[model samples]
Target chain A: MFDDKFLPQFEQIAGYIHDGGAVAIQQILHAGRYGGIDLGYCVQPSVVPQTLPHFRQPREVSKEQIKAMITQHAEAAKRAIKAGFDGTEITSFMGYLLANFNSKFTNRRTDEYGGSVENRGRFMRELIYAIKEAQGDDHPLIVRLNGAELMDAHGGNTEDECFELMKMAGDAGVDMISVTVGWQEAPESSIGRDIPPGHWNRLAVRAKQLLPNIPIAFGVRLPNPVMANQNIADGEFDYWEVCRPLLAEPELLHKAAEDRLDEAKHCLGCMNCLSRLFRDLPYLCTNNPTLGHEVEPEYHITPAVVKKKVMIIGAGPSGIECAIAATKRGHDVTIYEKSNSIGGSLVGYAAYDMANKEDLRSQISYYKTMLDKLGIKVNLNTDVNPKLMRSILHQYDVAVVAAGAGVDTRGLPIPEQEGVLVTAADVAGGKVKVGQKVVVLGGGKIGLTLAEGLSQTGREVTVVEKEKRIAGDVIPTWKWRHTSWVEQLKIKTLTLSKPIKIGASGVTIVNEKGEETFLQADTVIAASPRRPNQELFQEFEFMVDELHGIGDALVPRGLLQAIHEGYRLGVRI
Target chain B: MVSTADEMFLDTEGWQAILDRRQEIFTDMLPGASLGILPKKNFDSPVGTMLTWVRQADRMEVAYQSFTGFENTSVDLLMVVDDETLEYLHSQAQDNAFNEMKEQIRNGNVLLYVMKTLDELLDLGYEELIEVLKIPVLGACR
Candidate 1:
């Protein structure tokens, strides 16, 4: 609810973002039973208690209270118009006030605003009509409603009932309909990467069939623009409602339009943004570092005052990102890759899963396309050492060392068992032959991912970790998916286990409480404790005037840090 | 580094051709609308001098300025320098630039046109620009 007290803040935002051409829209909502418990009381259509412990129970609202609620919605819409917004959208999803009234799960009132589909939808209908009357019918109003509550067993509305509610809202003079799925209490992952792109299009298609005249904005785990366009072209939905994808890559539409779909940083479907929002923190993209700092001038890419010839060693994510950013700043960049191809760890990791492989491969393809387009010279199979660097000393003004990491077997105290033990990198890289019963030495992300991949190939995989948990290094948002995959694949994970000796036949492990066990394995793959390869960078530190170290060359970290470091260095240099 | 047409470092004629192509596209697409062409500042290159020549060229209400940064001002259309310039435009556009321009276009205020090179503009004809403009301006404002 907006009032004159909030006008100053709204005006300040409007003025601050007044880049001379903006159509700011205000969204109004009432939490009802979902309102803060600290407020002392909450009102709902009926006396419904929240399943979650943190949420408070709400008292039933009387008929007079319902009239007051409708009046409040109308007043909020009028305030939004006065606050300089082009229009206002009434939020009736995600277990909000209006959504609670419309949902059969929360609404048990025998009054006109409850019971049948029409009665359950009456509150929303009245709210929309009241808002339109308070402002004007031509005020570009929109109604945001859930296509499916995803709470089928919890007395939520069905797809048919939701479509009927949409028709009701459309008939009430809403300019457009925004379709979303799931609620706060839904027992499903609706917007995660696990859900394939355009998975919720059937909901939108049904809405279009029901309300053919009203425009539909479809969203809920749809990230691909190609698929979005195809759906629109096929008339499944009028608008592809994108939010998280835009957060991941701000220039998604622009890059798609320029035929640089690969160049566009696709949303990895890592729910880091959603995770942050759930914790009441500002959302950030795992891949794009400039996401939340849009207003900062430092994040804004500006043309370099002076262009220099830059030499980046290694063709990993960090190296490629540095090359791209530096080249974009008009610098002449040449990447010297020790391997024959690009995407150092990414190339190996892409082979771990079918869906993930496609996503990572697209990114690698984008890097290749961008490198080609920017005229960046990539020297493959050309490892840069001191002697080789001295030969090309005059060629580059600045040198960036991103030589990446090396596998260290120190974590596993097993004796050197030649020809029996292999690194997880080797197994993931498909360089080494894996046996039928393979024991992965570590339970980090690499180990778990490799285990999942190995299990897919019908190999009996066992991950032994000295630590208590597996995939500890994985991003929190994606940890569940990895754990679920490991579970589904039936990959055995032995925690609190230490390798004592590595024989030709199997490895001897000492578990907690002084228990010793022989985990028979045909082959052991070491996946943990990677040390940084800072030799080249350290050797050339004094030789060049401008020398920098980034990515795994500085320290063995994940892709988020590597890419961010590359981008930071690229912009700074 | 590998050499390409864009990396060749545009001379006076090359820059003039880019300016001419932009003027033609903007003039044709927005017909009788004021245009502002902002080229990235290259102190060591001849583009700065070439922009001076372009500013003096006989074009209808075309405002030319060399800026190292971005700013929003009064203009019917905005013409940028190169891919780097467009990349900057894309970065800013992420911060509600396109949405704002879409609103402006709907209200007959402004239009944003990005050209990587003179040839790219020529390759993307007026019809294509209209089609591209229609999406952000009319279709996908949200």
Candidate 2:
């Protein structure tokens, strides 16, 4: 319904909001990367170039430029008013253009637009005036802001200044204000990666205390509806802006109303959707494949396509999704699992706490339910190849390549004592035994998760990262959570350090200062951080009439990316 | 003197000529209007620039410049020329627009796609600029 509608389009949605008098938030879309980063549409950038002035790199506006932008916002508001929007929100949330201006790291200017807090909010101040002028003085104009900067360079922790800015927004005619921590520069850190649940929720409490008269809200990816309700009960926050979770499931609001709490599709704190956003690709969910492709005819499949014969190979998440997708298309999809049962590598992953296991469990459940609905055949104890799988190609019109990864134990060329070394997969599968102490080699997501699991098991663990930071490739949000938990569990993470050698007694590592220290470890897990599973992929390399590859077959990364690529390829067909 | 970065060359005059050539190529496609033509007057300057509303199938205006070898067509067109003939002409434009705008994004020139449009709008001449701009919206007609 909100198609190509400009700022004034809010009025249409506002009708529903106003009937209930629900708040009208101006969810401003800011390209934190601006034109530099490919936002959803490449054509928008092409619409106006930088020389066109409007196409300017959303740079920290000069007092003059800021005034002009504020005027445009005011004009947008005036149009919205004409369109019947009840109130105006000069959007500052979700790391939009204004947030970029607010960013301490990205905004390096020494002028009034940058530096100290008062000077920093110069642009925002002008914008509030524009909104006030547009609203004719008596409508709510709220400011969405960061309670903290997730990155170090941007000064998000200027608590007193944040308080001062809240006060300024209130006094300058801002009707309400909401505070969320983490900047768009590092959005992963903003949602839940760097901070704990209700992390920035407390910031709103502080802001509310500072400006007691004005209402304040906090944003987080809280999957637990009960916790959200309880936090409101506990007076910790005013309102919650559920971004990622809502992206994970848009029906969340209506479903919770029916008290069908378990039915609510939760956000896994995975950033697949946002990562796709960086490349202007479609949104992907760990569980739902219907997101972003809502416009397609087969967006939500009907019973008509439920009768065709379909074959899905490999029991991995991608293969499962393909089978599920094929089944939903009204095809009688049959899943071939090489292993005894379903839930490939995900079995080891789902063995973790529900949050870590949420995606895997829910998706497996979804596929199982779908397969049940269609009466599709699932054959376990089945391995497939070019010759053996030839019958499947002849049988089903479509074949999916979802064979889970082959064991890749590429480790350091350095030697290790017998029984002292165990790959992460072996440990994950519980086939290899670890002694009282352990040293994990790789710091990738898999390696890190394994280390965290070991630490939770009360094993003494030391993680040595060759890089300066342990979780660079991991989404900022997950990195923040995992890193914080690992720290709390007292897992020793040695950054900028390399394992010198591993002996039966322990492992020796050279620190950044070139100082060699031997840590006591009965076992060393060689999670050599993985490369693509070539052996499995090579088996089907040009054997079939049609072939497509995705997931770790592309690269060994987090489940989020694999989920995104899988969902994208699903809708493509 | 608007030079491209490093050994990257920028011939502003040549670019001006290439742009001028494109304007000629698409002259008939442009809107046309009458203007106070001060013969051989300055064109490079933003001031000598004037936009007039007019009536014509194609927008038209002509001028000569000191920095330009001949004149310009459009910056947007230069970044995405229709043919090798256009490329040769663009290369002749001394590739000044390359730094300001490019046919492609390599380093960090996502702006080229639209920057070229700006150059086209300017090279579109001033006489018929307003006529083209008066986009008759259905609602606005009321």
Candidate 3:
């Protein structure tokens, strides 16, 4: 309910809030033109996505205009205060205009609010003090501030800034500061990437070090409570702001309290929750269907009408989810996974990022729990063929296929030298060995992640993307790390470079100018691009009968698409 | 990721169909409308265009949409107002910040923005928002 489509809905809800509960108005001036992309998305991106070198909001903000914006902010606050909101959370994280004004990287103008750190922080500082005075101290004022965005491009903001802002807000009669990262253009990297688990803790610890008494909420992507509690145990952050995960599984807190954490089915950080933010789609979870369904429980979760027999084949995300839902509906269930372990491709992809892998494993545990609760039997390491399916067809009322797609390792058409090509899965599985000097041909997510790992391993790596920028489809936060891996590894990136030939010596490439050049490498990885081996056709009968096929089995795609299909199929079936 | 079609002419099942099929998705938005969806006539290729690298999408719920203060009939507008980054980046390729995006937009590799309201068009200081409807659709994979 954050877009234009929500305004009418807002008024209707605003009427209800006014009728009873209080409402707090949080307005973020996402300045898209300041530093990089001026991405209307990032409150204030490091580099405006659209660079207007000559255009600067600070320089353009005349005293009168500044007064106008401030007055507007105050008026909105005053209106909300009048509308019965207990207080407001001044959102500055994700580098909004106020946040950008605080960022030295984004603000570079010869104006009162653009030079020193104090000047850069003036807007957020002024707004807090102004609104605090307007609403009075102890009115429950909160500022969502960033300790760091984790992006190199967005000239990092640190715990020092958080501590400074805490004191300033205290002086200005502010109440709390919720700390977050990923404010810059590259979101995942803003806080932490999918690599190294609990990466944001260090930054959070730095903030707490400076402001011991102030409350700080950590906004990293946590798929489950174990990770959240672990972070709290580490004392890196004081509060855990469950936004996306909450969208993924709204019953998280309740489920955790009931000792049913696995049943909660954590968020995958696929960025779908925020996707709906663009169109007012309920912040959704690829696993949990009940999210954002406060009004209608039927749409999310339906209670069982009567116990029935159910059978599921191909135990990937979709298979597990189906088993869970069916068992919850009082049906006796059985699961068939071709792999030895219950987690299919996830077992391989689980190694992608520690935190993300943990999330995936946590969901896997949920499948185990739900299946066990419903007395669902699982036949592991047994492939489900048509004959086996027919033999059991009389025993089960419904059949679900989670059988995943085939793993496609399309070799490079170019000549291969020793140790030059590897499947993305093999790379993630740590099978691919990168030599001292490396060149990754494919620049997709796997290629990028693999490239990052190789670069982090301290190899001289060069990433040749057939496309312009690598990892274009990763979430903002992760996107940051994906690219940073390239920078942090000091990997040489050749965009708009096409690979014409590959050999043991290295790779032959034509740059954007179409000039042929050979990149010398000790080894070459041909993961430049690959396809999924969706097995939907094999499950055609199951889909026709029980109505679903999920994961790579159906589309032969990545986790994002696979998980989405799995969850949606859960509802349809 | 680039995909080729076979069953329905796609490497991945019609991702466009999957995306387009979300109209019935029950979510927070009561009547979720896909803004990036464009008329088939808008594209040179029937297949959807890919907007891989551009960043940040601003989701705005229009409080009001009017021309000279006269209101439009439909619910104001649910628009994803892109900052002039694409336009700005397209205009300045030589500049350091735009070196990456300039090549994409020029080559016609653009994710189209659906202009639902009159102000969305006017906000860009352009004559017609309706005309820009002939662009690529804006969306996310998951």
The backbone clash count of each candidate, in order, is 1, 29, 52
- Per-residue lDDT tens digits for candidate 3, residues A1-573, read 223444555456557756644344444343433322232222232322221111222223455666666666766665555545567777766545676666665665457777666777777778887777777654667777766644333344555665576566656655666766654233233322244345566666776776677766776644457777887888877877776667667667778879877667666665655545534345665665656655665554465665557677777776777676666655677788776677676665555552355656666677677767667788898877766766665676566666765434454454665457555655654566657887887676666766766665677778887776677656543554455456556777888887788877788988888888889987776664454434434544653345455666565556656565655555444
Kindly list the per-residue Cα lDDT of model 1 for residues B74-105, writing each as its tens digit. 33234434444433333342254433333333
Better of 1 and 3 by DockQ: 3
Interface quality of candidate 3 as DockQ: 0.04
Candidate 1: residue A421 Cα off by (Å) = 1.6
Q: Fraction of native contacts in model 3?
A: 0.04
Looking at candidate 1 chain B, the ten consecutive residues that score lowest on lDDT are B133-142
Model 3 segments more than 4 A misplaced? A1-59, A106-126, A149-162, A186-188, A195-198, A201-214, A220-238, A269-299, A304-308, A352-357, A408-547, B1-142
**How big is the positional error of residue A76 in model 2, measured in Å on the Cα after superposition?**
1.7
Model 3: per-residue Cα lDDT over B84-141, one tens digit each = 4333432332343222332333233333222232234334322212212211112222
TM-score of each: 0.74, 0.58, 0.61
